[model samples]
Target: MALEQLSALKYGKKTDLSAKLMNIHTKLRRYAAVHSGHANMQTTLCALAVDEDERAFAVNVGDSRMYRCRGGCIRQLSTDQSLVQMLYEQGRITADEKKTHAQKNVIFPVLGNASEEPQPCITEIIGGVQRGDIIIICSDGLSDYITQGEFEEILALPMRLPRRIAKLAEAAIKNGSPDNVSVVGVSMV
Candidate 1:
């Protein structure tokens, strides 16, 4: 599977982030098919769009997840596109085992593969943005290593987002990540 992460400042076309994100996904799918050779493999695109004007932020994705830890509440802002998620939705997997299951990372759609036409799953979440709101976009590796509560604790520290991201990578390594770990954390200053 291919992995990608991008965090950019909002200068222009703030309203077009969704379209640009979709375009990136389209290009990624073609690249995956021609090079990665997994045509049938599905793609998952997770994105977070911040709208300072509307005083809100929007999250969209297939498998990648976003989370917010404010005050004492830790909230997950994205959905997983995995068999385990399906099972969880169908009431087959318990809420506690959702992350501990062996197939927790078995995403139904990822970024690459060239065996068949790729289809990407998308999910969106919307909420108001606080001045110190912390937004995280990360691969399953990092997510699997640290629970949402742990992430909240991490964010609570007085550290920069980039440093926090590095800490996340370190945590994943410490937890024995078998796959590459990627993480991007953006905080509204």
Candidate 2:
């Protein structure tokens, strides 16, 4: 199970909210244990401190990634815990082979492990969210079916948040997603 959290404060210092962030992340991980398939899943939490005062948080898990699109470039804030990733790191697999690997879908780590230290990997990004900054969280199902360019195109549309996310999910489903697909997009005002 993985715990996911999203929080923001406009006036207070972020250091004061560390405890709250930790608590929220703990809860999200507990929830994942109850719902996700892998009993020993490992989760990664990707968060960002939005605004100059660093007051926002975003949490995520599994292969569902959080992307930051800024300065005309996109960066992935989360890493996938899959065998394919391992192979890639070991130089046993190539970028092209990553997609068709026999263990591509296997999650290497997630939440609910029976280990002693049961902890979720957390990432915190500081600074404020700019007007044009884009935050996207989505399952691998969407990434697998759509090209990066296609995703950029879909996200670049002027549609509302719900509609845009729905469209992304629909696209993945139409492209034959064998697993559940989920996506969340946030743009700071």
Candidate 3:
């Protein structure tokens, strides 16, 4: 479904992509609910769309993330829709506390059996990408194990995209990630 959204974004208007994404979300929710008796179907998702004009659009649900790297600095573009994040936002916990919070892994909005509409975090990069900028999309398995400083350190390395992505996954495994790890990195030329 995400791939279809990306393909649509390539040829469709950026402003229209949000509605398309919402449609996809709705379908996923319905499918999950219908198949609940046959399969375990909850999931966190993060998607990125880069248009011909080089602008970037992101939609995320649950704890998956998207990040932007430029000038040796890495910044997270997608906020985790999890209980820990909400606690931090409400000033009930410190940033450091969030990392080890017991509810850190408790995601609030996931793609399954929804009683309410899914609220995906959507972001737009207005001027598009520039040379030397890097974009990364990954699941919580990778983000949960790697610190932001570690992400910066790895991303700053002068390596090809495939190697960098491999190294990111390797680091997560080495850090004892208990979930599936997926990472995709794109370097803007």
Candidate 4:
């Protein structure tokens, strides 16, 4: 459903990206409610859209993340909407503590939350995606096992995007990621 909405939005003008994203969330919520019996099926979503002017817009739900690497440095662009993230944001726990927290995997805002509307974080990169910048979107299975510094190093390598993405997935698997790992890499040319 999300992909269908996104595909429909792709042909339209870029001015209404956020509204389109919200609509997608609403549609997904409706679908989930209609299929409430399959309660175990839930998904984290993170999407990025780059315009012709190099502006980037992102919408994220759950623990999946978006990262931007520029000038040899990497920074996360999406905030994790999980219990541990809330605890860290509230200063109730340190970053290291949150990493090992018992509820690290407890994500409240997801695609199928029937009790409330999913609140996705929307971010706009105003001329921030310059040429040579690398954008990465990944699931928690990869981010949970890989550090930002490690992403920086991997992205900085003089390899093709596919190879770099493969290396990242391989590294996460080697690091004992128990969940499914997925990564998408886009390099601004």
Judging by lDDT against the true structure, name the best candidate.
4
Question: What TM-score does model 4 achieve against the real structure?
Answer: 0.86
49-95 per-residue lDDT for model 1 (tens digits): 54446444444445667776566466877777677888999999898
Best by TM-score: 4
User: What would the C-alpha RMSD of candidate 1 be, to one decimal place?
Assistant: 4.2
TM-score of every candidate: 0.72, 0.68, 0.84, 0.86
Instruction: Write down the RMSD of all candidates, one decimal each.
Output: 4.2, 4.9, 2.6, 2.4
Better of 1 and 3 by lDDT: 3
lDDT of 3 by residue, 9-122 (tens): 544343565566567667676666677563445566787666666667777877889888888888788888989999999999999998889878888756543655557777
C-alpha displacement of 165 in model 3, angstroms? 0.8
Q: What is the C-alpha lDDT profile of model 2 across 1-189, one tens digit per residue?
A: 223244443324434444554455456557656875645544444444443555554444346677766654666776666778778989999978998888888764443334432233346555435677778777787777766666677777788767877888888899888876877777766
Kindly provide the TM-score of model 1 when superposed on the true structure, using C-alpha atoms. 0.72
Model 3 bad stretches (over 4 Å): 1-14, 33-40, 51-54, 126-128
- The alpha-carbon lDDT assigned to residue 28 of candidate 2 equals 51
